[model samples]
Each structure stands twice: as C-alpha cells, then as structure tokens.
Target: MKKAELLRDALIAGNTWCRANPEAITVWVEKVGIETQATGEASFMYSYTIQALATDFPGDVDDLMLPLLGWVWEQQPDLLLNPDSNRKIEFEADIISDDTADFLFRVPVWERVIVTKTGGVVTAEHLSESAMRINSSEWETVFDPASEGNKA
Candidate 1:
C-alpha cells in the first residue's frame, strides 16, 4: 500500500473511538507533492483530513488528535525530531458545529525505495521510516522519552 493509505489507516485504526464508531468519522488523504532523483528514490508528501461527520459525537474534536499524532510519531519520527525543518508536520481544524469538525493534517513524509538489479531483472522494495532508523532501539517521542512503545 502507499504511504498515504497507510497513514490514513493508521489514523483511523489507532483511535479506539474511531474504530468502534466508524460511521462517525471520515478520513481523506491527498498527495501534496513528489520529488524524484536519479537514484529512483521518490518522496511523497501528503495532506490528510479527518472529519467528524456525526452530529452526535460524544467527545470534543481535539480528542481525536492524539491517536493520529501518535501514528506519525512512530511511523515518521523525522517530522517530530526537528522543529525548525520546513518539512515539519502541520495541522489545522475547522469546527462545523458543536459536535462536528474537520481536522486537516499536512504530513511531510517520505518512503525510501531501494532499487536493485540482478543480472537480468530489477526490483524495488519500499522501506518504512521505522525500518530506516539510525538507532536500533524503538522510537520514542522527544517530549517524553519514558513513553516509548506507547502509540498514544
């Protein structure tokens, strides 16, 4: 699957409230840009929007942010690592009503594709951010190192 799809899935799946009440929320992922080099490695930037569709949602719109942020933290640590980078993740929210709102998140993330040739054929394999980690240990939020392995 593409990184955008994985991100959308993770955002929805990570939230217990979203999973339990699927009809109450909606997620849309749009590719913002792409860059390719001579090495065949391409970077895809995506903007995903999560909309609270139900008029009777039980919780505040802000409550839905943690799970999505957690997914980004674990899958794409670089966005959280550098605050001054232009590629940092960003987000905004528009409240449609007291119970419904639209949350748009701009995530500048890239998936590394390692291409190789074997005599007669060439193949490419995509690598996840966690797979390309510099540190072998698990990824932890910079704000709180003690919260390792906790997605939320």
Candidate 2:
C-alpha cells in the first residue's frame, strides 16, 4: 500500500475501534505545527504532527498501542524493512518550506491510556515505552523546542 493509504487505514481502524468500544476506547486526534529552517530566505516551514489517544482499555497501554502499531505495520510493511523511508502509518505528509498544514485523523493509543493511582489493571510504564518508540521513530521532533526556533 502507498504511504498515505497506509496512514489512512490506520486512522480508520483506530477510529472504528474507538467507535465500536466507546466505553473502553476513547480516541481523538491532535494537530500541531512544526517549523523547519529553509536553506534560502523562506519565512517559515511547517509540518503536521498527528497523535492518537486510546483510553480505558482492559489491558496495559502497550496492549492498545501494539494493535495500533500492528495495523500500521500491516498497512505499511515497507516501514519495517526500510530505515530511511518515510512510510509510517500514523503520520504521512509532503511538506514544503514556508507552508502550513493540518492533519485530521484518529489519535494513537499511547496518548490516552493513563495509569491511575490505584493501578487498576493498566500500567503506565508499558504505554510510556511504546509511546517512546513511536515518538522516537515517527514523532521524534514533536517535543523538541530547538526545532521551533529554526523557523524564520
């Protein structure tokens, strides 16, 4: 599947799952702007930052994130085989310098499932790890303050 198609499938699947299980799953999308420096006299550059959130699952956060990741992996197998390729199922974009864009889609499970103080049945550590992997792989620069200053 094409990169955009893969991302679309993941988003649809996540939304479907959330809709089907509203009591256990709460999914939402968040769009953020990313600024990058241009080589020339460009005033600004922007990219889409999409995150998925799944909450109140019966199992750990990894349990939810793994399935979402699996959907992404199944749709975009090239991402697993190619290190340099931008074939992620969660976020896909063709950004240009000095432009603004917004991506609307279902949020990932990592962002939602919070561990309660009672430690009911979910654990935050697992979710944190899975989120870390996704962040490091696809959303690496989302939290980087230095990258924001790169804009003109």
Candidate 3:
C-alpha cells in the first residue's frame, strides 16, 4: 500500500473541506528505520511531515489532524483498539512563521512477505490485514446517535 501518498491525499481532502485551499499543504515522507528477517519478513518506519503555508491559517491543528487520524484508524485499527501496543505513533507541530507551519508524524508501516514452495511451485503472499472491529458495547458507545440540540 502507498501509505504516504494516501495519507497526503487524505490530509489534502481534509484541508480542502475545512480550509478551502488544498494548495497550501505539502507532504514529505522519509524512512527512518527498518527491520528485516531471513524469513523474508520486513518492517519499515517512516516519518511524514506536512507543511502548510498561507497568510491566514484557518482552523486549529485538530481540524487538520482529524483526517490523518482517520486514515491511521483505517490502516491500523489495532493501534486504537489496543492501547498497550508497542507501536505508538508520534506527532509534533512547529510554527515556522505567520504563513508557514510544519507538522511531523512518525508512524510504522510494514510489509511482510511469506513465501511457500511445494512441488516446484513457489508462492509469495503479503501478510497484512486492514480491518476495524468493535465489540457490542464499544459499537453502542461509538454509534449511539445524539439527541436534538446535543453536541457530539
């Protein structure tokens, strides 16, 4: 999966919806760490930085982060569901000027390749799951509708 590109697109979509100017955002991604095994399994860590430039920056950081968080939720729901998970995403914000600000997010993205051979035939598969699960009580907590005049 193209995590960085998709994340950039998600942020752009969020900014367009909230600020109406997609051009003000620029995203850069770099790999900071990697782990690989002889068994053909590998994990990669990346830092994605988003730079927004405009004379008047509309909305707060939360507004910009909502979409990024949503994307992360889609990619790794376990990160949200299992608080004890060791892979913790980190983010930082730096205000460069009245017109420019930089937001840095460090996240782990991995690709695992599993290969099998039988009868002179070889098959390789990428072992990954992108799923979101919620239990009954958690579902109720998240999906319960708000009453009239009640803010979420």
Candidate 4:
C-alpha cells in the first residue's frame, strides 16, 4: 500500500467507527503520535496513537479504539502504516470538530498532510497546500410538506 492510500483508508475507518460509537460521529483528531516497535523474531512495527477530545469523541476512547483498529486491519491487510513499511504520515487534521461529518472530511483533512519515507530510515514530504474553506451561507429551512408552516 502507498502512503496516500494508507492514510485515506485509516481516515475512512476512523470516521466509520466514530459514527457508530455515539459520542463519536465526528472524528476530531487532536494528537497523532507514531512509534516503532522491534522484536527479535520479526521486523519492527509502527503504531499510531491518535487522540481526540470529548467534543470529538462522544464514545469511550478505550471502547472504540480496539474495534476501530481491528476494522483497519481487516480492511487493509497490507496497511502502509505498519512500522516495517518505513513510511509515516502527518497532517494538521483540520483539528476542528464543529464542521465536518464522518468520512466526508478525509479529502479536506489529508490534502494538508506530509508523507515521509526515509532511505532505509525516514524521509518526509508534503502532499498538497490545498486548503478547505467553508462558504458563508445563510441557513435556510426549506418548506416541509410533512409539517405545518409554524411547525417547520
């Protein structure tokens, strides 16, 4: 798996899991920590610690994380995220909770990230400078035939 694709899938899984995890619904990533682990019998493993605030995580972090990680593994067996891949990605993550919905924000969030792969070590590079801005539009409630004018 490539860097971009790996990040994309991880984001998607996060959003999906959040939606079902109540207090979730919005995956506001606050802190993204990366670490590598090594074992004598095998290669090093990469792990990510993605933290979130109460505002972004309505569900229990402990309860949701295991399943979320499981989903990621099931969906992507060749996950580019493993430490062995010699690859890592970073981004500002929009870092907001009041706006985007679940998976819908992946594009806007990831476009601002940097993916690094070192030569037998670690190298980093930015994906894009593309920024996402919300337009200032007044909220207009359309007529609901199912409800009376005042009820709407």
Best by lDDT: 1
Per-residue lDDT of model 3, residues 9-66, tens digit only: 7777656542466556555545544345655543333323333222234556666666
> Model 4 segments beyond 4 Å from truth?
1-24, 27-59, 80-82, 86-152
TM-score of 3: 0.56
The collision pairs in model 4 are 18-25, 23-58, 46-83, 116-124, 117-123, 118-122, 118-123
What is the clash count of model 4? 7
| Top-scoring candidate (TM-score) | 1
Residue 20 displacement (Å), model 2: 5.8
Please list the C-alpha lDDT of all candidates, in the order they appear: 0.55, 0.37, 0.54, 0.33
Which residue runs of candidate 3 sit more than 4 Å off their true CA positions? Answer: 17-20, 32-57, 96-100, 113-128, 136-152
* Candidate 2 stretches greater than 4 Å from native: 1-20, 23-47, 84-152
| Candidate 2 local distance difference test against the native | 0.37
Cα lDDT over the full model 1:
0.55
Per-structure clash totals for the candidates: 0, 5, 0, 7
Error of 2 at 99 (Å): 44
